[model samples]
Target: MRKILFHLSLILLFSSCISNKRITYLQNLSDSTAIGLEEFIPFAKVDYKYILQPFDIVQIDFASSDPTLVEGFSFQRPMQQGMVGGGGGQGSDPLYMNGYSIDESGMVEIPRIGKVEIGGLTEEAAKNLVQEKINAYFKDDVYVRLRIAGIRYTTLGEFNRVGVQVIYKNRATIFDALANSGETSLLGKKNKMFLIRQYGEGTKIHQINLNDRALLGSPFYFIQPNDILYIEPMKIRQFGSADNLTASLALFGGVFASVLLIVNLVTGGI
Candidate 1:
């Protein structure tokens, strides 16, 4: 009896608390953590926000740059391993992780633009601004194509899935990733999520509340390139609470052993 109880306690103690993290309840979303209509929040503080960092990839096309509209803003994209393997043969197709790195001088060289400044420009702003610059040199048809070929974001928190997401869509929202990455549980404290943003040499941290309707207007609602969001878990979910579980097992073991001993004595011949 003692040996059995000892083994049971050992097994329970080592087991992980947050188990079965996958959202198998996708069939029963109502019973799941994602609930209530979320009040949307804008990306934090609308400063001339631009997520492009060194080694970022961008694609620019021309609606009509003259079959040879002066090469249409020439640029370059470097390839790398998908991180699945930093060594080689990462994939049969060899996934192309694309992006141009910002040179220490804080400029990106174009075949024509020639070392243009883009460190602090947002996707939309960068697109519009780049178009104007292109039009100046070309008088014919000049529709511009701008995209963040290697932009991404990192979501860290109570979520079942946590990782850095590479994006091609020049635009996306925070809620977008949260939903796609397996939404957080009801126990996830919505009001205190953290948004870690990098601006030049400094990084800014913002506290946000998912539960508050005011978030609809907050600038942080729209996720930016290279932004990292961390959603913290509630305090009660802390470790050591499992210790109480072991104590309960110990109590049950005592009662069972006492009862068995008493039964043995009563049935024995005097």
Candidate 2:
């Protein structure tokens, strides 16, 4: 009976404890504490570029050699000098109000230009297409500038803060998104998180292992608009607050004492 209890305690301790390797991000190729620059020789970094998709909001700024055309083509209302929020946090409401959204047919309606197809095109391609359209109409120096409003993403499950988060940047990495949303909880699964991305074709889920170094080179390293990052809770979460050694030991002691007290009462009654 004593041996059985001893083995049960060992099993509980081992199962509930999380190792450092599982939580650490971007592990080296050789899995060494001290890695040299030589390890990066074979690592090929992949550059991730975001392609515009349907329902994506785009910020359009128009400038022209003729100043009147600028006011005519550009529809965005100027905000008060101190109205803009700080800390890389731009509210989605303002962007949605001022920006143009791509329709299901991959078209965005520009002021006086009507609807123009831009979905599935890169930022540069979309900008050039808009430029050509404006030039054809005005036949003058009409410059068109285009940018994605911001990177808006949602986080679910085992995160410190779950829900929609907006980062105001042309490009943002996975780490940047995580940081904006307060990162994951202690019980969050670092190795097996999922990134649900929306493409022009359809939505696809990609498994992301944050602990692996190869993630830095993966195309999914960069966060795209409307991305959903989900971190599953580790099995240790089922044990509640007894995830650490001290807590587990205290839990074991409490259970053992309760069992002994019950056994003593039963014998005494008998």
Candidate 3:
């Protein structure tokens, strides 16, 4: 019986302890080459440009010397909150309604410019296409500005906060996304996190290993709009609450004491 308890304690000690390597991010960057890990590739970082996709919302601003010329092209103004007469005013408009959504056919239907195809094009390319059409309408006097509304993403599984989040920015990195979403919990498998992203053809699943330094050179380092980040829990998490060494030792101690009490009771009866 004592021998069984000794083996059990050994098993629990080895299995329930969470290691620093499993929780740390961007490990072994300087010694990556020496450790037989993949070297950082330069071209992958240079060639990355986010392409516009269908269902994406973009804010378009048309500016001109004559305000009336661009009035029809303006989106509805979001409601301002204040005391109106004796009661409060209207609340702010929904974010989606503030910008024009790209239709299934990859076209944005403007008031006079009609439907212009901008999907599959980069942000610069899309801006140029829209600028050309605006130039034709106002004869080059009208200035057209275009940008994605926000970097919207969703976090699921093992995150401190799980749900949709939107950051009003042109571009956001994976770290930014994680930080904005309250970051992952200790039990989350940083090495096993995966990303679900949308593409022109369809959606694709990309694996992201935060524990690896090679991730810096990967395109997945930067998160795209409507991306879903899912983190699976570590397998060791199921053994017990091993978030820290103190917790693991306390849990092992409790189990050890409980077994000892049971053994004493059985021996006393015998």
Clashes of each: 19, 0, 0
User: In candidate 3, what residue range of length 10 has the lowest lDDT sum?
Assistant: 83-92
Superposing all C-alpha atoms, what RMSD in Å does each candidate have to the true structure?
A: 8.8, 4.1, 5.9
In angstroms, what RMSD does candidate 3 have relative to the true structure?
5.9
TM-score of every candidate: 0.55, 0.80, 0.80
What lDDT score is found at residue 208 in candidate 1?
70
- On the 0 to 100 scale, the lDDT of residue 130 in model 3 is 95
Residue lDDT tens for model 1, 135-169: 78777867876666544677777765567665445
* Residues 160-243, model 2: lDDT tens digits: 778878888877889998888887877788889999998656889999989877777678888888899999988767665323
Kindly list the per-residue Cα lDDT of model 3 for residues 1-270, writing each as its tens digit.
777877877887787667889889888645454234465456345464667988888888889898889999987776745412111113332456568889988899988999999999888899999999988888648888888878878899888778777777777778888888878988899988999998756888988888887776678878888899999987766654334646766876897889788997897798
**Residue pairs with clashing backbones, model 3:** none
lDDT of each: 0.59, 0.78, 0.78
Q: Per-residue error at 156 for model 1, in Å?
A: 1.9
Off by more than 4 A, model 3 = 29-31, 34-43, 46-48, 80-94, 239-256
Better of 1 and 3 by TM-score: 3
